[model samples]
Target: MATNYNDYFKKNNDNDNNSNNTGGGFTPPELPNFLNKPIVWIIAILIVLAIFAKPFVVINQGEVGILSTTGKFDPEPLNAGMHFYIPIFQKVYVVDTKIHIINYKRIAEAGSMNDTRGGIKLYPSINVLDSRGLPVTIELTFGYRLNPKTAAQTIATYGFNWEDKIINPLVRDVVRNIVGRFPAEDLPIKRNQIATLINSKMQEKLDKLQSNPVILESVQLRQIILPNKIKDQILSVQVAKQQAQRVQYEVLKAKQEAQKRAALAQGMAEAKKIQAQGTAQAITIQANAQAKANKLISESLTPKLLQLKQIEVQGKFNEALKVNKNAQIFLTPGGVVPNLWINAKDKQKASVSK
Candidate 1:
């Protein structure tokens, strides 16, 4: 270790003078002779090693090192793992390349409300005037990451204030501007569209800030706070729409039922018409059969059949003639049958003759 007096340059000058005065093969100054002891040399060598190793850095996974000389960031950057630089004349700034999550909402997870690990709640809600001139509060969370390819550009452009100066301000401006274009009722309906718009807008601004881009992975719109009256009105409108749909469905169902009954009635009427036609056809067939039988009988009649019929009538007349003297049975000259006859003039003459 250099003492306060030695650190001031006086001791360094004296050492250089003594080395010039030695006039021998380039022997180190008196300090070396004093440092000749094993322990002293060991300590000196260790100190020298430490100084050389001071600028050596092991950049872990997902980390990049930016070289800075005399407080000026170098254009070239170092990748992960072991690297070396000039000590006291140069320094390295380590930046994480992994994604960073920043939440600006107070809404918690399902169980925990105050978990600090969730995220830092900066300004929770963004107050904006919507399209309808109504005030709406939007709660949101956004994700970003330091671009690894152009580590030097990132460090040079924003250093460690990328989130505050570039990302945060741009987010506020884009989100507020976007939300203002939508009405209070439309905000919730267009939440996804709003988030995508904010992400794209913010990305455009952040990309312009540095050659290495800070990518916005996503933006989540948590909640839209609106007045209770507006919510109730929206609910009523939804209910009315539902009721109208139900009525339409019932009307359609009744129409279908009426169609079904009409089809049944049509089928029954057709069946009855068919039955009536069938009955008329049956009666016609029976009449045709009876006419055929009567024609056969009339064609088959003969003289012998007529004589048999006359004999039957004569027998019946004789049976009646036995009961009364004035009655007598007889046949015509051609053998035609005289069945029965009553004459008032013949009855008077017959009684006078008797």
Candidate 2:
């Protein structure tokens, strides 16, 4: 039976092979390649070239660039505009060339007006003596700017925190030194002069620093403080002095008025005396004129005028006798009338004598 089965299988295989040969033959389609190694390498090289090329950076107006080579400072600086630099090795720092302002105030430890903390706090108390050795408190403000060209040099010489190292110390020193020279009273009255002095001192100190990174523009005294008790005392004294001055002025005015009145009285007395003298002199002159006229008339009288005067007297006597009941008459031979007498008894008598 095994032999019969093997012969049957072999006969079936030969029959199938004969059938395929008699039928038409079939073929399979080919697939294309997606990626090649040379193409991939070319794309990578392009990407690397783009990154290595140095790119330009634009610096804006009113700005200066600080160039550094390999993390170190470059001797030359770049001005405002587009500038080229090594992408990996060179670095650029931009600094503003224009002026800048900063404001600082002194604060207390507990932040109160009078409280003070230890070790020179942000807003610290300053003690100074005046000409009178009185203690005073002072507050001040100042304006400053960074020097553009010397910024790097300043930082290099005085460390990166140059504002704290150079600026703060110099301002503190100048303020204290200037304030120390004056008294509490002068601080308010001479504030402008004090500011000028501080500014001059600050400039001198800045010049000595040699860094030239910071410039002191101006200094101002903002506030002046004094002990309350002392202030009150000074005010009271000033008031008393002013009152005394007012009294003195009133007295001076009164004295001037008195002097004017005295001068007027003296003038009136002098005028009256002159008028009396003038009146007396006029009376004397009139009396002298009348006496002269009387003397002239007496000197012109003569003997003929005397005889005429005698005859006129005799004629007046004769007229009188005719009306008189009692009359007496006497005549001389030189043309004089003889004596004649008429009595109340009706007796009449006449005498003729030589």
Candidate 3:
């Protein structure tokens, strides 16, 4: 039975092999021909091409590219837009060419008398000799710009640490030199003049140092720390000056008001005088007119005119006596008979006599 089983297995295996030899057996699918090639070679070629094309870099507006070959800086700069470089041999660094602000605090701990020292550790406190040779601390800020043309040189000479070596030291030196010339009191009050001096000196020194890459825009005094004993004295002086100016202004205002009142009074007096004069002139004119009328009347009264007037008066009296029942006559000087009547009969007789 074992021999028969082995014979049967062998017969089946042979049959399977025979079928595979023919077209009756199944076969597995093959991979694409291109995938059969070495993938490392293709990857190496792509990397090489990418390295050669490494020069394609876009530089935006207001930016400059610093190119270096083998760690040596190129003299010429790469301007904005697309620029190309060798990948392995050359390097490009982008720098913003626009204005930038760097805020440096000169006094960090404010409002404390003990921490009055300026915040910056780069420079020692400025020593300005007063008349008494006292030390004063001054805080200030400076604005600067990086010159694009000299940026490469600055990096080469100062190794990109120019702010510490060139800028801060020069600023400290310039400030000290300028502040030393002025007294402690002048540092706080006359800061404008001090700033002007500092700016001028800083510009001169920077030009000398050939660090023209950094430009000083403006210098401003942030604070002045004085000894506690003298602070009140300085404040008092300033207050006195202000008070004096206020007093002067008040005096000037009062003087102007007094002058205005005096002028008004004078105007009123002048007007009243003119009115009184006019009244006096009018009275004199009226008196003269009255006197003239009296003179004319007296001049017209001659002796004959007087006699005619007397006769006229006597005739009027006689007529008046005729109308009255009682009347009388009185005799005066120069045969002048003034008529009077006692009764109607007497008045009729008197009229007949006239």
Candidate 4:
């Protein structure tokens, strides 16, 4: 039972050697005594970890890495991902390539470069003199981003404060130059033109700069603060224009109404004339038909037929005269027919006449 552990290991090693020699089995080489130490294994593991992990940086999205050796920046920028640098001899500077905004506003409460939200910087609204020497305030927002291709050169030339040197000054200068070209009263009216001019001028200047460090995304003109008297005058002009438009609309409406009434009256007069013409035409046609019928009757009459009609009328009158004794008859040139007749039935008058 208390057999020495060292003897057990030695015996096993001796058996392994014998098996390897006789049975032709392969044996592993023994490690050195120094290698058996736990500290040496731990040191090797740490060395491997340090090589892979230390003196490295992970560049996030929308960012580029600037590598500088001893104080000189590399021209080509490192893209987003892990980057390696030599210890103490090299360093990496992360420059943001994402779009950023600079808002020139009326208030100054919004902090400067320290603003953490989307790298937006705020400055006081630009105060400039108009062509008339009147004071004006200009409010606007500028959008831009560092050119990733020339990020290193941009940083080298302008440093980390590239926005101040490239963007801020350029924007202010362009705004002042463009705004000062016009009178204060015209600023609000020519806002769009002013914005276009400022954008083009700023972009032109930026492109002309060495290496073109910043890419101009947008330049928006938000507001133009004019003097109070100019504001009042503009307001008055707007009111006058509205009144003129209203008057023109009313005049047009009246003209339309008058035309409608005239049309209605003309339509009524035409209808009455057509109705009168139709009535006259109908009367004329009826009279012509009646006259034609009478002519036909007259043409169909003969002497014999007239005599027969006269005989029939005489017989009817004779019968009538027999019933009324006081009846009197008068004949015409055609004596077979009575032309006039009277019946007087007063008895006293009949006696007197008889």
Candidate 5:
């Protein structure tokens, strides 16, 4: 390292001079006169600087940089910041370690970067077959993050196109595999189940990635679309079921009304019978009381009582004559006649005259 440049240059110059003298077919390549100027050294320096600049990479925040030495990736990854490596012999590939969203939509979704709204809005979605072999389209969105621990492996496996190469393929395959377990009609209703299965299977699939694999955060099935014919069939079946239910309900209601009417009629008949029996008993009691009273009164009376009552009535008749002698009376049922009564002292003579 000490002053060996002089000896080294002297030896190289001697070899060149001897080669020229010996006259080999090989000749010293001549340099352009421009390259010999001062500007040429500056250009050479710039070229060296440019070559040296390749190793100094600026890894932004939320990024993980992997180094490839001589076309092979280094096991150790570089975090966000500036890093240096051997120029022309190595390269650094930056991986965004931030969480990434993988969205697929059919209906307009809120928080959509596309800003699309209702009406004829179609989006790219995953179409797969259900258990019935019917095609179903799923609109989904999920989140993921590159595992920093596996950053080197990720770069080696998918490089910069992990979404297309790894994430999407696994997602599509997992979704189809999971969704295929349900009937086409059930897919729309079983959206949550489908999403759960997809997430689980996707996580399982991601765990199998070359190195540390991607961390699958979540999976969601936003919308499910079935064939129009299937939807119509389902609707028709539902309508028919509703109609049948209504008919059954009406029949049940009619039966209940009939039962109620029968009960009412029976009750009315029973009440009438009770009322008639009570009335008959009351009338019999009244007739018996009247007959007993008449018997008692008859037993208490005698002939003497009868004679005295006649004498009293005669006295009343005499008083009545004194007041109104012209008053007429019926002597018998066959004729109207006048009173023939005289003084009670002349009873025998009055009798002879009548």
Candidate 6:
């Protein structure tokens, strides 16, 4: 910290002198005359200051920086990093490149804005005229991102509010145009078709842009708000359809039950017919067997056999007359018929001998 400038300079001078005389020791090179000038030093100091305390912008991830020289924006965008620019003549605009959402819903359905970021925006549900000129409300959500490659050009052409001028207008116009092609009542039923048309049309329009400024991610149709009368009519139609289906099902069930009962009755009738046929057959068979047995008995009978039977009957009568002394005995003409005797004691009773 002590003063040593004089001795230090003198020692360097002596070494230079010795080098000049002996040509043995190394000599320090002299500074250029221009570098020693005050203006040159000032310029150097200013350059250093510019490097250390420069005007700068940070291009974060999911962001791109657009450099502007004077008023014209550079076509090529700077990637994520610290970017320096001249204070007055140059500037860099940091634009987000991440996916962003635009929600079109009823005003009553919009949530608190405090939770939203620069990337998320909310608008009132789109109102469009149907083919019948009836007003219909369309609620939807779509995602998009700034094309980093063309972000600068997009910002230059559409300004920083490009989403409003480009996306919002495009979406609303597409919805109105497409929705206007159908009746209000049809919108709910054709919601998927409407949504598909909207997304494709928007993408087509975006692709038609010079730089393809926005990349559309996806589009979702959240709700189709129809008039109360249309809703009531749809509900009534659905209810009527349900009632008709119920009636048809009941009719089918009744037909099945009737068919089952008819099948059962037919089965019972066939069973009774079979039973009657069996009984008739059994009676005929029995009568035939009994007639055959009687025929055999009649074929075996002879005249002598008849006489023998008559004599036996007479012998029995004689035995009976011995028991009842006054009994009256009578013989039939042939023994094929048995003889009869009347008891004298009981006039009403008679005895028969076989």
Candidate of highest lDDT: 4
Q: Which sections of candidate 3 miss by over 4 Å?
A: 1-44, 47-55, 104-132, 242-268, 295-312, 323-354
2 against 4, candidate with superior lDDT: 4
lDDT by residue for model 4 over 187-240, one digit each (tens)? 888999999999999989999989989999999999888899889998999999
- Which portions of model 5 show Cα errors greater than 4 Å? 1-55, 105-123, 240-354
Model 1 per-residue lDDT tens digits across residues 1-354: 544533444566666778778864464434544543467768988889888678599899888898889888877667878988888888988987776776665443423332335334355457778888888777787777777777677667776766666666777788789998988887777888888888777777776774845766778888888778778887898899999999999999999999999999999999999999999999999989989998988777688887887788777666766666566434467667554443333655432110
Model 1 CA lDDT for position 272: 95
Q: For residues 241-352, could you state the per-residue lDDT of candidate 2 as single tens digits?
A: 9999999988998999899899889888888888888888888777787777777766765667656755875776678677874665544455433333444445554433
Candidate 6 clash figure, as a count: 0
TM-score of each: 0.62, 0.54, 0.67, 0.76, 0.51, 0.61
Could you say which candidate leads in TM-score? 4
Write one digit per residue (lDDT tens) for candidate 6, span 1-354: 654545666688887998889868777876565754567768999899888867888888998988999988989899988887887799888888999998888767567532355777888889988898877888899899999999988998889988878988899989899899999877888889988999999999999988899999999999988888888988998899999999999999999999999999999999999999999999999989989998987887677777787777777777877887998766655545576778778987755544
Better of 1 and 2 by lDDT: 1
Which has the higher TM-score value, candidate number 2 or candidate number 5? Answer: 2
- After superposing all C-alphas onto the true structure, candidate 5 shows an RMSD in angstroms of 15.6
RMSD of candidate 3 to the truth, in angstroms, is 10.8
Per-residue CA lDDT of model 5 for 259-301, tens digit only, reads 9999999999989988998898899898898889889888876
**Candidate 2 lDDT for residue 36:** 29
lDDT digits (tens) for residues 29-102 of candidate 3: 44455544557558888889987676578889777788989999886778888988888899888776665333
Instruction: Decide which is better by TM-score, 3 or 6.
Output: 3
What TM-score quantifies how close candidate 1 is to the native fold?
Answer: 0.62
**How large an RMSD does model 2 have?**
17.8
Error of 3 at 346 (Å): 17
Deviation of model 6 at 228, angstroms: 1.4
Point out the worst 10-residue segment of candidate 4 by lDDT.
345-354
**RMSD in order of candidates:** 12.4, 17.8, 10.8, 9.0, 15.6, 9.5
